[model samples]
Each structure stands twice: as structure tokens, then as C-alpha cells.
Target: MSWQTWRTALISAAATALVVGLLTDTGQPTHPTTVAQASPPASGPGTNHAIDDPLTSERTRAWREDRFGMFIHFGVYSHLEGEYTRPDGTVCRDAEWIKRQCRIPQAEYERFAAEFNPAEFDAEAIARTAKEAGQRYIVITSKHHDGYALWPTKVNRWNLRDHSSFDKNRDILAELKAATERHGIKLGFYYSIWDWNDPDAVHPSTFGRYKERMYAQLKELVDNYQPSVFWFDGEWSTDRPSNPWLTQDGEALEAYVRTLDPKIVVNNRVGKRRLVDGDTGTPEQTIPAEPVSGQLWESCMTLNGSWGYAKWDNRWKSPADLTRNLISIAGRGGNYLLNVGPDARGRIPAESVDRLRAMGSWLVRNRQADAVHGAGTPGIVAEPDWGSVSRKGDTLYASVYRWPGAGGSLTLKALSGFDVRSARVLGSTQRVAVSRSGDTVTLTPSGAPTNDIATVIAIGVAPPAPAAIGTGTGLKAEFWANRKPGGTPTVTRTDPLVNYNWKYQGSPDPTILYSGFSGRWTGFVQPRFSERYTLTTLTSNTVRLWVDDKLVVDNWQDHGPLLSSVAVDLQAGKRHKIRLDFRKESNEAVAKLLWSSPNTPEQVIPTTQLYPA
Candidate 1:
């Protein structure tokens, strides 16, 4: 589905769930009490514990290096081909959610399950296609929101082996697992939290039972296939009114999954896709406007208009558009998980295969695969007007999406004093003429771009060594017991940064309760370059910030993760007094202070730039 529709559904679902009960529980303990909770090395929020988890960091790092993956959305709905004909001679068009959208009765939906025979399903062919697409991993729908399992699940009979005419012994998941292993491609599962067919999941009274089976199914997946990633979805109350999938439930499930496989990387969809929920944020269908703050993210988009097979929806994005999107996402430090919906016969659409092959061919011909594998947001210079820039160590890969006319030049301005050592186009022997005028560098290519999709220009630059750890002592934080900080402080400490997510924790200090607390941070913010910087604050409650004794941001009202910013001019090698006052009114708390300029990427105010006042 499109991101706009998903977001609209989320709002409606959240409202409906909130109306039913925001924190409804089924009398089950939400904690993994048997397992010890790991603490992050720093004083970050409890939500960020997974980000700094020592046990799984290496695995997470490895997954991040993969960069690009394929998402397969295949299920019983594929048989409908995004259409359901009614007895009245009318038709309903919807993909994946055809049953729900068409108002098909439960009996009718179940009856169709028996005829869901995917005779052409070839797991090795699918894996080979992904390999040839230059994709490092594949996340297939083990079970979508329809609650039909692809494997021969022992938890219930609502699975391929038991319900469908497909060979009982030939499990699609198992085949894909072995095939992915053989192809050296990591495999992952996309499991839905909401089960439309499960009676226990739909009714509030039997929700606890559903949770038990869900845990069992997840464990079964882990023990049987040993997937590298768990991409979850359908956690909201979009159709079901009494959805009891709360954040605490997600927390418990995450803990349980960790016990099952400590190396598996999970997406934030495990808990409303919050920053504090899981290992990475799952941005569906649309790439984020910027790199997500304080969390790693991946953008999952479909090859066509729908994630599931849609016979009529043929609005396929061009190969150039897709490749440019991948480069844009990589430039923003995110992975791209492109989706392909197989037909009822289990054959991937020829359009998708052709596009995937084209992308793979381009990457191979241009030798740009290495440039995208572990690339991140460029730190040497600002994003240029011509294209996006991704950084891997000191090397910058500038991907030109819009090629300039013949004899035209590509210019990069507002650089951060990085000395350009060399410039060359990838997959070509032509040398790129590089000239620098102060902070601006102009690159004149020897010839036109190698490919019309995107031309990769490799720039080798030398950045200066970072400042020492003790260059700044950080900001002084004063915590108060009440919502107002006028009274005597309850505790005092030095906080490295103004980033916190106190969702499952008590007060900032041990002296106060979780809610109704306040904090004041005072420091001197030092910039690395002189420019007009946008100082941003993301908070779940009231906050006010002052720089150089001038109040720039005065969002002194309660809110939920609202981002507010104000531009302020600051000079390099100068200290500006920065003061932020925050109040946690109630419930889950979060606060983050970030800054970005023409030359700097959006990031948290570093410890080295924050000196105690």
C-alpha cells in the first residue's frame, strides 16, 4: 500500500484502539522477568537499550552492511489478483486486503484457501532472481495479516500444507531458507501481528491465547529456518476494534524473540514503529525526508502500485527511478527493501524481474555495488543539487541522477574543509578534473555519464582528526521531582547529549517518579563551522530552548514527539550559551536536541560540542 494510505489507516486505527482502551492488557505479564534486561553503556533512554546491545551489535552491523534486500508479498490473496467478484456481478479491487476490503465472509475466504495451489513456486528461482538483482537479502511473507502461514505450521491448520492442495512435504519457507543459504543471501520473515482469521486474535477475551500462539509460531520460525531478520506488521487496530497489541506486548515479544535467537535483527513495527521499539525503523512505501533521528531505518517499497498481486495496477516505476531511489536512500543512511508480488502460480511478474535484472546489470557494469554496500550520509559536504552523496570512510560516492549537458560541470559547495585528493568516475578510466574555490569544489567529467540511470563519481577526501573525548565536559543537568524545576534540585549530573527515550523507565534520577518530572540542561554549544544552523528539538512534552540568552524555540506545550526547529547563526570556534528546559507531564517521555547546517548532516548535538555551563 501507499504510505499515505498506511498513515491514514494508522491514525484511524490508533484512534479506534485508544477509544477502546489505550493500555488494555489480557492479565498476562508483559515483562520477560526470567531474562535480565541489558543496559546501554551510556545514560540513554530505556528504549535505546537495543541500539547499544553488545550481544547483537555485530549481527546488526552485518545486516546494515547488506544495504539492499528484496521483499516478497505472497499469500492466498494473490489468487484473487486484487479482485473479488460478488454474486451481484459487482467487483471489488484491492490487493492483500481483498477479503477485508471486499467484505467477503469468513467462510468464503476460508473456502478460497483450499484452492490456493501455487504449483509454479520455485524457491531456488526466487533466490536466484534476488541474487541477480544485486540484493543481499530477501524478506518473504511467512504469514501476512490474513493469518495464512506459508510453512507447515504445527500451531494451527491454517497453513499451506494443511489447508491448500500444494504438496504437504514441500514447505515454501524451508525451501527458500535452504535456497537463500546456498546463494549466500540472508533470509528474513515478514510476520503480521494482527491475524484476521484467528478468532482468538480478533476477540479481546481470547487475545492472550493468540499471544501464546504468536510466540509459539515465532519460535517455530526461528528454530526451523534461523532467519536473520524479523519484519513485523499489522499491529494497529485498522479493522478490528478491540486490538490489544500494546507497546508492552511488543516489548515482551521482542524479549522473547531475543531468547529464541539473539542474533536476529527486528524492525520497529514490533511496537508502533517507535524509535524505542526495535532495532530499526521500517518506513513503508516512502523514503523518509531525512535520516531518522536516533534510529536506523529501512524503506520498503513495491515494484508496482500494490504489495500483493494486482492484475490491473501497472504503474511500475522506471529502472532509473528505482536506482535513483536506492541511491537517495543510501545517501540518507538507510537500506532499501524492494518488494515483488508473485502471481497465484508463484511466478514473479515479468515486469519486476526485468527491472530487477536491469538494476543488477547497471550496478555490475558501473562497479557501484561496493559504493552502496556500507555507505552512509555524506559528512564531508552538503547534499548537492545535481545528485545525492553517500560516504564510506573517507571516500564519497556522488551519484548523479540528473546528468548535466555536455561540457557542463557539477559543483559542490559548503564543504567542511575536507581536502579533495582525487576524483574519478566509477567503471571508467577517465579522470575527473577537480578544482576547489575555498569550500566549493567543481568537478568536470571527461565525458558524458556512463549510464542514463545514475553516474557514480568517486571522490577521495582527507578529513581532519576528530577532537579528543575530553574536549568538553558536557551539559549540566538538574532534575526536579515535580513538573516545574523552580524548587531545589533533586539530583545533578553531567549529560553527554539531550537525547532520551524514557518510555519504560522511572524518572531521570532515582529521586523522582516516572511522570511529573522536569529537567534543565545548561551548556555552551560550539559549532565546527560558521553557518546558519537549524536547531531542532523532538519531544513528547513541553520544552523551551534558549541560545545565547535569546529564546529561539518556545514550544512550551505538551505534545507527542513533535519536531520544532529554529534557525540560528553561529560562528566556528565560538561558544554560544545553550539552555533547554523540559517537563515530562505524564506517560512515556522522549527528548532530543539536534542541529544541522548547510555543511552538516542532521545529528544529535555531540558531546564534544557541549560544555558544562
Candidate 2:
């Protein structure tokens, strides 16, 4: 993404860069936590660029449907609850960062390991709560920054079973896995690659020893319990200069894990902010201010002021906020990993349970608004003095966040070209009356909203409006049999834009997925400003983009391409020359052209902005 995209996520930046930095360890808000936004990471996996096979596709597809999940942050920090009082008298507010904030000696901090005893930690109850709250998966911290493991491992003797006095013989992971399996709930583990307690964590020469320990632990966990998702963190201390080879080791571990279990889903934090081949982009405590597109992302956030348990940090987000955030993320085509930090006794807060159940009830009533198995993500529409609107296929859900008045109609400006079929209140059968006037579609519900929290009006849209026949109206793709463009092409076609995934199609448009097939697209792009623009190229095999005879992006590679961008300058209202080329060497094939300008949302260059040149 462009600079604006990263800066717009949330909060003030710290020593270590984060898209969303809610606060420093000092307990002060870095930026507004109400709503945070993040584009994709600087660079990582793009749309469906993974090594595609039957198993990989099946696992990722299932994971996508299981959009909602619960994130558990339980560790020794829960026992402290931010109770560290500094010498200057002020207490360190973030209990989870106690090691860093209190500056405790490593040997002294190791004592907290034995104090870990959570008899109230009922795995079955947690799984049931997630199921009740409409969540399909749960991820808990198997190991955290404190280097204390929640389960027994031969490689790491400083684990719950090895150090804890209460249940030194029991394995927390084994027990949790058993309980979740009983409830038919998917379970995962959060592994911290950075072990501060390890001498190798600081000593570069001994880093190899640390890597061995981490790999052994990871292998043991995976082999023992077939985990679905692996949430990796603490790969590097980006703020400080530690071991330089940590990232390489992280990459090696990811490769090794895939050999163990190809179906296991890994997050983007594996090698310091998605430096390795990972599945999902994990954004911490941030919601997109507006809708997001292109890449798949998940927002991992705490319900309250702190990530881990903080006895005094009870400032929880309201149920309305939580439920809206969930729906909002779903609408934008992402997942919400809502977090809950259990207390020392491993009991989830009753208040948190209440909020989750409330959201679950809402989900039950507005199942259509859940955005599951949807054809399209919600596009921002101008609904003047009205409510927000989200879409799934032909259905448009007008989210009733605020009422215009006691009895008033909603005017959707974006529904100008869309021929609406009918409108109805969610959970009700009666279709409401809809009227139109000069590109303004208005809807009036049969009666007042029954639910105070959020009411949704399901507007049925007719098929898309047909395009007018004319040149310079859309994109044109021409194919050639040879490596370079020569005489007349073998096949030619026009499309609204470039978006192809030959994995499902078996062959690209006007070309085959394998062998030497060259393709070219010629069009005119209308720029909005005389500023630098980012042209992102995502394709299988080799792909290149040229703007006005200048090669803006020459990203040619083998296999599924990572989303890469290049910058160029263009003036407002001016039609600039645009050309894109694609070459398919073997296997899967795809080609997508996306762009973003200063102040404009990143998007595929639409037909309105493209013309035959």
C-alpha cells in the first residue's frame, strides 16, 4: 500500500513500527482505539499466491468460512494483573509487559513460572462459550514472552508442567485439545519465537541453540496435537538489535512445519510482520476506518483496556461496539479474533461472556448480515442522513446504526444504477415499499425498528446494469502464441477489469495456464491528480505494467506472484497510456492490476476509469 494507508491504521508510532499501536507500555493511548484501519503489510502474501493443492485450498477455504474466532491471552501475567509498583511510586499499568516495565532480573522473573496454577481453566467451558458466541475457532497462548510454556515439552523444561507446583504432571495443551475435540471445536496455539529467558535470545553466537529448542517444541506440539492455526509472535525484537539471524530461523521453521502438516494454517507474524510465507495478515487491535480490499486480514483485539488480565483495566468496549466491529469486519471481508484474557484461576470474565453472548444473539437474528460465503465485499455508498450499508451477493444490508428521525426514509446514493427488487426488515417476512427519484433510491420500512441496538433492511438488488456498447468503455485483452506481440492475436476479449485465478479455471483468459502464452492489455487511465500513484501488480509467473511507455512495474517471477507496487506521476482528468503484459510458464495463472493514488482508495482500475487506447 501507499504511505497514507499505513499512517491511517491507529495511534502514535513507537520504537518498533506497527500498523496499529494502541498504546505504549506506559498505558497512554497512542492513537484512537475506537476504530483503527490497516492496509496490507508493506509486503507479504498476496491474493491466493500460496502453493495451491487440494489440501491447501480445502484448509484455507474452510478457515475463511470459519471467520470468527476467540483469542486467549493467558499466562503468568494474569497472576500479576499489572501490580508492579515502580521505585518512583507509580504502578506499571500493563501487567503483561511487567518483565519489560518492572525491569525484573531474569532469574527473579523465572520464579513466576512455578506460581502458574489455573485449576479453574476449563477448556470445555471456553470452547462452549466460543460456540455460543458464534465463534468457530479458538487460539490460546501456549507460550508467551516470559518464556513460560502452558504445556509440557522435552525441549523446554521451563513449562507449566515442569515448573508449576500445582499440576506438574499435566499438559495444558493436551487437556485443552481433548476438551475442544469433545465439543467439536477447532483449536490452535500461539507460540512465541523470542524467548527472553534463554541465554541465546541475547547472545548471537548461541542463537543456533535457541532455534533448536524452538523447533523441537513446535514439532512436539504439532505432532502431539493436530493444530489448525499457528499464531506466531516474538520472532524478533525489532526495537532493539538482538540476534540478526532470528528471521532466517523463523523462515526455516515455517518451511519445516509445512513438511510436518501441509494443512496447518500459519499467520503473518511468523517472521517479523510476515517476512515469510504465511496465510493471513494479523492486525493487532485495529479496525479499518473504511472498507478494505485485495488481501485477507484479521483484527486481533482485546475487549478491554489490556491484552492480558489487568484487574484495574476494566474499561471494556460496549456490546454494541463489539457486535458492530464483528459485523463491520465481516462486511469488509475479514475476520475478527476478539480477545479475552483469563484471570489467574483461568476463568473468563463474566462481563466478557455476557458481551459475547449478546453479540451471538445479534448474529443469530441477522445471519444474512454475517457476510459468510459472500460474492462481494461491501462498497462504501453515500447514504445521506441515513444508515450504513453492507452487501453480500445481490442482497444489500442497510445497517441501522442511527435513526434519521422517528419515521423517515433512507436515501442511498450508490444505488443509482442498481435496480432494486424489494426491501425487507431482517428477521421479518413483510417486504417494505421502495421508491426512486433521479438516481436516488429511497426505502421506508413497514414500521419502526424492533431492536434498539441495530436494525438492518435487506434490499434485494436486480442483476448488474448492462454496459453500453462502445470502444474506450472497458479493458481489452489480446493474446499471442509466441513470447512477444507480433501480427494479429489468436484470441481477443473485453472485460470490466483484470481479475483472474486460473487455478479454478484451469486456463487463463485467451491463453493456457502452461506453455508460452503472451498476453497484453491496452487502455486509457483517467488520473485524478498530478501526484505519485502506486500501481500494484499481482500475477502468476511473469507480469509487467507500463504507464505511458515507461515501465512503472517490471515484476516478473515464477509461480503465484506477491503483491508488488511501483510509483508514477500523472495529472488530474488527463487520460494516460496504460499497458499490462502477462506470461504463463506453467501451472496456475492469474493477472490483476490494482492502483492507488494520493488520498484515493486503493482499487482495481474500473471501467469508468479505463478506456480502449
Those runs of model 1 whose alpha carbons end farther than 4 Å from true positions after fitting are 1-59, 89-91, 203-206, 240-263, 274-279, 289-294, 469-478, 486-499, 504-506, 509-511, 521-536, 545-553, 564-580, 593-613
Candidate RMSDs in Å, in order, are 6.5, 11.4
**Residue-wise C-alpha lDDT for candidate 2, range 510-555, written one tens digit per residue:** 3432345667888878765455567777676787888888887776
Model 1 TM-score, all chains together:
0.82
TM value for model 2: 0.70
For all candidates in order, the CA lDDT equals: 0.78, 0.65
Which residue pairs in candidate 1 have backbone atoms (N, alpha carbon, C) closer than 3 angstroms, thus clashing? none
Error of 1 at 97 (Å): 1.2
List model 1 lDDT by residue over 1-613, tens digit each.
3225555433332211211111112222211112123222232232333324311257678777777899999998998888889889997777887766676665566667777889899999999999998899999999987788998877777778877778887889999999999999999999998776666676668677778878878888998999999999887755443466877577667767777887889988887787667778888878987666656789999888888998998999999888888888888878999999999889999999999998888778767975678877886677887888888888899998877777788998744666889999997888798998987889998787888888999998877544334377689999888888887798888988787766645457655777578899998998877777889886777889999999988988787657788989888768899999999887667677888764565667878889998
